[model samples]
Target: MPLEKIKVIAFDADDTLWVNETFFRKAEEEFCALLEEYLPKEEANKLLFDVEMQNLPLYGYGIKPFTLSLIEAAIKISNGNMTIDLVQRLIEKGKAMLQEPIELIDGIDETLRRLSEKYRLVMATKGDLLDQERKLINSGLENYFHHIEIVSDKTEKQYKKLVKHLDITENEFLMVGNSLKSDILPVLNIGAHAFHIPFHTTWAHEMIDDKIDHPNFRSFAKASELLQIL
Candidate 1:
């Protein structure tokens, strides 16, 4: 259960390695304000969340899906009276999100630099494959990882497959990320160690209320703290 056995240290992309959810939040605010005439700001925001949840299967996760959901929510709220120009504006919002700068979290570079020297670093992230790749390239951290996995989703099955691909046992893997749902629970469930490095902002869909009490589970306030644990 200690760091002594961790051979491969995997990290989640989005909010873990760089700024992600904050851009989504800003887009959501802009979207709600854009549709304020059709519905109240709060109502518009709630409807967007509903549409996003419903479309998760069809569109999966990323800016493209989010943009489509925003459009669908706008049309439904406006009773099919949403203007083409407004829809165009929404599309532009998604483009802006995709184009946003990849700001690495504070201390991420140093932590990754130090950890890569001691452990085999892997980048395990989920999003549109192209978008994820673009962000990785822009982040300038691609060289830090020995293996890069851009998965569609994160689950016990996915993590198991990752371990198999890495030629490592579950006990030798350690996952660190901001999302409990995608990063922590799945890895821990698969008998691997997990660390929760929570970001200030998270997506509504990724929220969880239960506390993780497993022996292999640990929490840190920031990436720098991992140095002490490692």
Candidate 2:
């Protein structure tokens, strides 16, 4: 498998195109602080992540689900003794996050601008549909993408569907993103090419420990680096 076969290049949203995980991390710190009396910051953070994983099937991903998880975790951490005021604050926190301005990743705009000229670019990511769309519009990179594929989760099956929908074979698709778990591994498993451009922060649920050594997989430190090889 070489670069010449790649016909469609799909990019992950959130941390891949712009800033995302940092807000979640900051909110988590604040969340733990708000619940400091009930649990230490480290323990509270772990509990929150556990609650999120448990709720994923029901709620999917986004600020709304995260907000709900915050409330649920808060109640559980406080033995169901948390006040309504605390819940209100969590609600407000989620609203603030949804309204936060988009910050493009360094070199991402240039990378996208350049790549769009050579390939059929698509934004293939998983998250709450409305929120992801909002970010895409605000990101100002929407025009560069020929198609947008937003799913509840990124998996081998989903990747296969995307390739079919694009009227391309698995070997003709290339996925670029920050998370190895959601963005890199599954795409590669589907016999597609994948490039990992890791962000500084990653959600606990998206973390993985395995070393990747696939022939179709490559890792880079920044978005611009894609130009050198692509």
Candidate 3:
């Protein structure tokens, strides 16, 4: 049976709605290549990613402070050569991240517009509060969503909270995201429906080492095509 009976449709804001992770991955690569002479490729990226992983507890998720982590790694390894030039470059990159608004995935808005008329639309995104809010406010789709939840993590806790607030059952709602670990599994664990759309660029931290081949999880190739499954 298709997920046609779902009354509430919740969407993941990051890669599901638009392009994300790719910019950061490119930044990380460029940043690492700059230091690749001093550090092994694996060692360089691992160090940068480690610094970022630790900063998550303090800064949460966003491109602003993630750029800072890269700067920190560069400075720490610069051997007293950390100049104003490097810092200035990092600052420019961070500003670019902040100013460049949402890049919607193909057919995302059109599909959402169609779905909004039939089902309750909610933004189920997880990231830094201010950054996520800025993206939403600029995306021009803010008016379409009835509610938005930005959290540190996308566990069952957040999903349960949404169900409680909306007065809906787990079975009546559908969770859609690019991340299987954070977005698809937990909701499916609770018996809610899920749609998984793999991203073109995936962050190392957000990746799942294991693959999923399950009955309840529906994987779609394009955003517009999601309407068919629904």
**Tens-digit lDDT string for candidate 3 (1-230):** 34666888899998888787878877877787777767876788888889988888897788877888978888766764777887888778877877776888889889999989889999998887888888888888887788898988888888898888889888888988899888898898887888898898788777877777666788888888888856
Candidate 3, which segments miss by more than 4 Å at Cα?
Answer: 1-4, 40-42
Models 1 onward score TM values of: 0.98, 0.98, 0.92
lDDT (tens digit, per residue) of candidate 1 on 37-89: 88999999999899999999888899999999989999999999988999999
Error of 1 at 134 (Å): 0.4
201 in model 3: Cα distance from truth in Å? 1.2
Candidate 1: stretches off by over 4 Å: none
- The ten-residue window of minimal lDDT in model 2 covers 197-206
Residue range 1-230, candidate 2, lDDT tens digits: 58899999999998999999999999999999999999999999999999999999999999999999999999999999999999999999999999999999999999999999999999999999999999999999999999999999999999999999999999999999999999999988889999999999888889999999999999999999999988
Whole-model alpha-carbon lDDT for candidate 1:
0.93
Backbone collision tally, model 3:
0
Give the per-residue Cα lDDT of candidate 2 at 148. 96
Worst 10 residues of 3 by lDDT: 1-10
Candidate 1 vs candidate 3, TM-score winner = 1
